[model samples]
Target: MTYRIEVDQEICVSSGRCVAEYPERFRFDDEEVAEGVPGAPPLPDDATLRLARACPSGALLVFDAQSGDEIDIFGT
Candidate 1:
């Protein structure tokens, strides 16, 4: 299974929550926007969801691995 994590660089506020919670999967780039590391091992679904929800600016998006649908962690 594969997962896709997308960060809206324009909307990101450099909160660092995603990197702090899942360093192996996310990191802050030179511009300070959270970036998903390519080829990183797939993280557990719950962990992925948590990281997406942790983004205070709601810039992180986690796609369902199988369905390719966006997971709305905040129920918004």
Candidate 2:
């Protein structure tokens, strides 16, 4: 299933971790916040989940597109 990957712009620190780890899936937007590339093919959930977990600022958010359920990588 496809996933809706995002970064909370307010919380983002432009760490580049997500972009560094998944350049094909994430990038620095015009505002420098990490943003998922629109229209990119779905990446494996595990891969995207790992990027979300690696976001030091906890700004990355991943949700199941079909289910609209947030995948809490932080386990909080």
Candidate 3:
């Protein structure tokens, strides 16, 4: 199953927790736009949830690519 991650720019506070936690799967640009795509090694794992849970601004989002089923790691 393919999956993706989207960050809410409005709520993201430039916290690099996700990046630090899941460097392979999560990334942020200078604009602090977090993105998640399928990849290998160091890819996002349950640890991503930890980062998401820790993010005070609540920006992390996980979605199943085929089903569009979403998990608000940060809790909407």
Best candidate per lDDT, number? Answer: 2
Query: Model 2 reaches what TM-score against the true structure?
Result: 0.80
Against the unseen true structure, what C-alpha lDDT does each candidate score? 0.78, 0.81, 0.65
Candidate 2 C-alpha lDDT tens digits along 1-76: 6667787888999999888877877789898888877877767877777777888898988888999998777663
Query: Cα lDDT for residue 75, model 2?
Result: 67
TM-score of each: 0.79, 0.80, 0.58
Please identify model 2 stretches exceeding 4 Å from their true place. Answer: none
lDDT of 3 by residue, 1-76 (tens): 4445567877787777777766776677767766654564433456555665777777766677679898755454
Sorting all predicted structures by lDDT, with the top scorer first, yields: 2, 1, 3
lDDT score, residue 44, model 1?
Answer: 76
Write the number of the candidate with greater lDDT, choosing between 1 and 2. 2
Model 3 spans with C-alpha error above 4 angstroms: 1-3, 37-45, 72-76
**lDDT of model 3 at position 27:** 78
Q: List the residue pairs that clash in candidate 3.
A: none
